[model samples]
Target: MRPAAGKTATLFKDTPLALDGGAMLSPVTVGYETYGTLNGARSNAILICHALTGDQYVASDHPITGKPGWWERIVGPGKLIDTDRYFVICSNVLGSCLGTTGPWEENPATGKPWGTDFPVITIRDMVRVQAALLDHLNVESLMAVIGGSMGGMQVLEWIATYPDRLHAAVMLATAARHTAQNIAFHEVGRQAIMADPNWQDGRYYDTGARPEKGLAVARMTAHITYLSEDALTAKFGRNLQGREAVSFGFDADFQVESYLRHQGSTFVDRFDANSYLYVTRALDYLDIAGRHGGRLSDAFKGASHVRCCVISFTSDWLYPTIENKRIVHALNAAGVPVSFAEIEAAHGHDSFLLDVPEMDHMLKGFIAAAARTRGLTGGTGA
Candidate 1:
């Protein structure tokens, strides 16, 4: 039951993972990574849920892409998440292809990849598996749960599903539910993958012919939604790619087009098309209010004691500040301890991961206050 800190770890469960769509997945396997150390009280643990396309390599280099961990900016030693002071645990969420049980993983019963046949999972289901992982590690409660974007949805699910398991929660650039625009964007991505003839109906695994073009196209479409119009204009305007005049060809003549193409091409190398479909579907299906009988406050009924912090970026239209305010309002109605902040940033939804000193200061202050209440020291732990 000891945590396999630093390296990848797995937990096997004989029971089944109940899905919202009324299906059961047995022999569940959860892949995770841990940072820092667990103190004697074991109450210093912090759970970080990753956003879409993010993996377990939170504070370390990704083994596949060889890129620095996505959140390395704020989770390392002496940083906001301070690995030296908090036992940080991050897992490749269920329905994700990165070392977790997902469409890309083998189905225990069929001996083949689940692919499109995988049961439709929800954010709550993802949180359930994480809870099981904590149970295996004997972590009865967490100091805090933090996430942004899709990761933020998971944080809300965690608070709702395991109300008393965490003392504080930080949700950044997220919403309580997906909007029509969100669903439309995801549908476009799904269509892109399905339209690719090489997909072979989600059986492209091990096949020499993969739907790389479709997957890349899908990534390109989704990547645009991750940034703001202001950021896009600032980074890549209508400026031509190379020559002074327009080429008048379909070839990426614009700088923005070239940038998006690069984003798509690189994405196909590391992501599975089927996994993307499943995860986006999960995102679209996330609705805390729907799960709680059309009452968002009902979702937080049992979490009244848990402190909540909601963060929204000024330019994040994907999950705008209005959406975050909905959560805060619900928490207020539910009588839960809550705080809200709207930070001004030009990067849009991706601002949470960028260099935002304000976010860092806010996170540090929140965690420090929470640590003091938990009787934990401020400096690095032994």
Candidate 2:
């Protein structure tokens, strides 16, 4: 199955893409989707970076899943992001298995998919590719760059690396860096993938078999982290699955187990296991502070000119409110104008992506204020 349908793909040749790991891809490809119309001066463009397991189909139907856009709640003509007033765009990141060139892409040298041979990439690398896409689109600057979770990490990198390219930035349900616990959780997922006998050292492709089982486990493990314990209890708890009592055997006896098994099973359909490994590795290496001599505030020194918002969810233990608040504190220390909010959510890290009215209102207000400052209805700030 193709990674994307009706999406735009750009092939950039001649110019080598220098990765954060000191490797290069001379003819990297990017897959992206855009909505609404770009204003005359391109002053009303917004970039919506997506989280892991998400694609460029931000405001469109998923070709594979047949589900409405993941953020359909926020980006329609009359929604919070208002397609009527802004030209919004989303792109699959560099190392994703989507339409973008990734581990599944053929390696000219080996005459096979890159697989484990794909060079390591970072959040900064992903943002750099996005910067290139903006150049290709002729959007000299953006009204705002917004993201959540892994996507938020990309936004943070954008502000740090290309602060002058965007007028405002929003990072929701994220932190300046991954905590030890976060890395540990990811490690478990990674190990689950590698442990699969079918992993075949990441070269499972064209082998007539794939590591779907391992990939499912990985997705299942990570999915649990995206939810709060309260949410789990409310949604499934110890309830039996379509039965009055336990099965006594290990066949998804509980509703929660059955739910997770379904989640993992469906995930393997649309996502590639190798891409999962590559993307998770990139996340594990996220160290915004480390790049700036171990000081988070220093990472945003040049972002003082950008308007910023850092949001967190009350139940999101994956990257808790305190971790997100640290980012706000760093932006403040860097003298940037910023907003901070911890929405009372019961869905944990996934709260930002869910139908949270408080988050909607907060984002609407911030974006509206930023638009006014941007003169969205009139002359370009240029």
lDDT of 2 by residue, 189-269 (tens): 889989998999998887878888988998999999999999999998899998888878989889999999999999998
| lDDT for residue 303 in candidate 2, whole number 0-100 | 88
Best by TM-score: 2
Off by over 4 Å in 2: 1-5, 378-382
After TM-score superposition, what is the CA distance of residue 120 in candidate 1 from its true location, in Å? 1.1
What lDDT would candidate 2 get against the real structure?
0.88
**TM-scores for the candidates:** 0.96, 0.97
* Tens digit per residue, CA lDDT, model 1, 89-119: 9998888877778887788778888877888
Candidate 1: count of backbone clashes, pairs at least 3 residues apart or interchain: 0
